[model samples]
Target: MFFNRQEIKFMFDENKRLNSKVKEFAKKNFHPKNFLFFSDSGSGKTTIAEKLAEELAKRREICYKSNDSKFIDYTNQEVLVKQELIHNTWLLKELLNLCEKDICPMNCKGKTKIDVMTKYNIITAQDPFDDIFNFKKRIFDENPAYSKDKRIGLHRRFSKSKDYTHGYMFKVTNRYQSGKVDFQITCLKESDDSAGDINDFVNGRFDIKFAEETTLEEAKKRVYDDDFENLYKHKGDVFLKREVDMDHVLGGVICDVDTENHTFSVYNKYFDSEIPSTMIPPKDLNRLNERLRNKIINQFGPDHEITGTNKRT
Candidate 1:
């Protein structure tokens, strides 16, 4: 029999309660662990993630960004989407502080760039800066200024110390993981500020980490193994271990997607043999392990049972 008015109201209320419960469960318990969304370039992963993030944000869960280095100093304030989003900056305000002294061209004129070159121990400058700065050299090839000791007595000084310039300080990071990522985040470092070191990145201190477009083996070696785990134990960084027991089944974006053609591969880690070898996941995710799945088919016919995302339906 059909329900009456009161029963219908009660049913509606119960349905609402169940829907709310499902949302809560998904928000709390549902984690996409080593899960890959097989989609094309315009398949709308970010669009879906955006809607999901907005819902999660309203729940007040701690979802900060891990990409920006500029926000490290201002960690206390701001409801940051990405914590390190702005931390690795060479703050222009620092130059304002430097300008409190006498007129300095490097600080007063244009954009000042700084870098920590691993090959070069000493930091150099484009515009001549500092108080004790002097003309180093301006030796011409044909008409060489060999006797170039003007102050000492023989020749004139070639370059003058630039004393009136301005600049806005800025800091940068390694290339981002993807075009869709909004988080400009980075992590805390134990060493001095160094720009764009792969070691610094793989160390994984920042909120958002990026796996650059590189070799599959290289990505696997950096994210997995003893050294990475050590950083986990010491730095308290997030560790999402991807355990696999398959060959050529590395986990990442299923590169070169032609789903209609039924060909794809992940760039994470896979096995060459029985051992965990470094390689991409098999191009054909549809390929069934006849030996392994045979147990199921023995009980029931091959076409009767349903398989999960682990293998193709």
Candidate 2:
């Protein structure tokens, strides 16, 4: 026997009630030791969490004295991973330097783009694609200004003060199981604003930053290299004037800028690698700035608009 529309609506409302009841039960009875919440969207999971917190407060004297709530909405987990990688960048920088040497072992008479070097098949002894993606290429990109001696200044690029704050605001866990300090570490960046209790690099208090919240499905999805290529391909018209779009784009674009070298590495989100680095050529710097100014004007239009142009001439 099929139910009428009235009955169906009743069932839907009743189902919601039952869901809330179940959620309440799960929240109160279950102890969160090493737990993870996995559920579909709009399933009252988050609502249940709020309700549970209310219930817990009602049951006991709840304290909210701590001022450590900060939120950073990572565009995706890859960006979070990039932040973690930056935290342990000393180790990565060393490995990447060796890879750079392998790519350009000796002084060349002329400049060599990384892509060109790849085509020549001379930089194939070791592939660091998996280790740090295209970090080596970005760090060692051929630029006439920097490559005059066939050597790039790692000091300029790897300046810790310039790259990161001395505050050590980020944290990663390193576990030792076999009597050896584990070099391979699992990184977790908290999206919650709860990690702001510590001091940041410049003797200032650390504040949490958020990008946007990711759904359970998105959090669980596997990120890949092709995804990044697709993102770049569809980067769309850059209207830097729009704060919302800038935030969205910045979430996806993770780069380590070497202002001295005029080069920066864009992290490959999908492949867990680095893309070949790029630079604004010194010669074209002025032209690039002019073009960007024109593009912004074209996109945003003139600041002043005629207010009283309704009268017909």
Candidate 3:
């Protein structure tokens, strides 16, 4: 194998146990709620979540929320709700809980008049990095041209002898007599304060900050080697039969509704392809309304495909 067999085996075994626990939790007769399963990169969190989504689908209409449309391509068992849906669902849950206690002003009973322009501060924990990484991953995976541009840019920026550039430390990992393109890695966050952005965010304010480092070679392999099949080994094949143009739907841009034509237009910077109103699928028209809602920075899933097209992460 060209990879670490031992690490892969460990991940597979741990994911099996994690999937069982997730399935059990999903099977319980609990309130309709949102569950977030998170882990470090290449740790099989998505692998386990995909399996759990299948097991949960047996009970209720499970929705797989992510920015990555590829996940939707691999599974028809769950509804694909983008990041907006996930946030709306979470907010709805909070409002419902407050309503049950008769403390919310926006309760269905309408005991009091709800006022607009109220500057209410809603503070929620946000995972901004994961979303960003995933969105970049999707683009790097799907658009070879964009990926090549990035790779070339990095090489140019770090052309000096073995050293660190910005936060990344580039080093030649192996050399061969055949004069093959020498394999190298760009490692980052070597120490607790290596990442200045992260350091600035949590420095002085927080005493503890956790970090993990992975080689560029391993990261790139994980991206290219990842397949939807490993996630659904026992579930069989899944085909997307919907007429929805996912490329437009999940391509990351908010659509503009043309009321006169009764259609929507989506733009893709990657292709410079603007989906004309006529090409828009009726099922995707709903996303036009979603754009009206205030955009939240800290959405549920790590910024997936949706963030790739959105105005901002």
Best by lDDT: 3
TM per prediction: 0.16, 0.14, 0.17
Tens digit of per-residue lDDT, candidate 1, span 19-90: 887642111111111101222233333332333233222333323323332222221111112211121222
User: Model 1, stretches more than 4 Å misplaced?
Assistant: 1-193, 207-313
The segments of candidate 2 whose C-alpha lies over 4 angstroms from its true place after superposition are: 1-78, 82-158, 162-175, 179-313
In the range 32-79, model 2's lDDT, one tens digit per residue, is 100011222322223323332233222322221111112212121111
Instruction: List the candidates ranked by lDDT, beginning with the highest.
Output: 3, 1, 2
Answer with 1 or 3, whichever has the higher lDDT: 3
Evaluate all candidate structures by whole-model CA lDDT and list the values in order: 0.25, 0.22, 0.26
**Candidate that would win on TM-score:** 3
Over 94-174, each residue of candidate 3 has an lDDT whose tens digit, in order, gives 322321221223322223432111101111112222232222434453331223333333222212212211221112111
Off by over 4 Å in 3: 1-30, 59-61, 66-313
Of candidates 3 and 1, the better by TM-score: 3
Q: How accurate is candidate 3 locally (lDDT)?
A: 0.26
lDDT value for model 1: 0.25
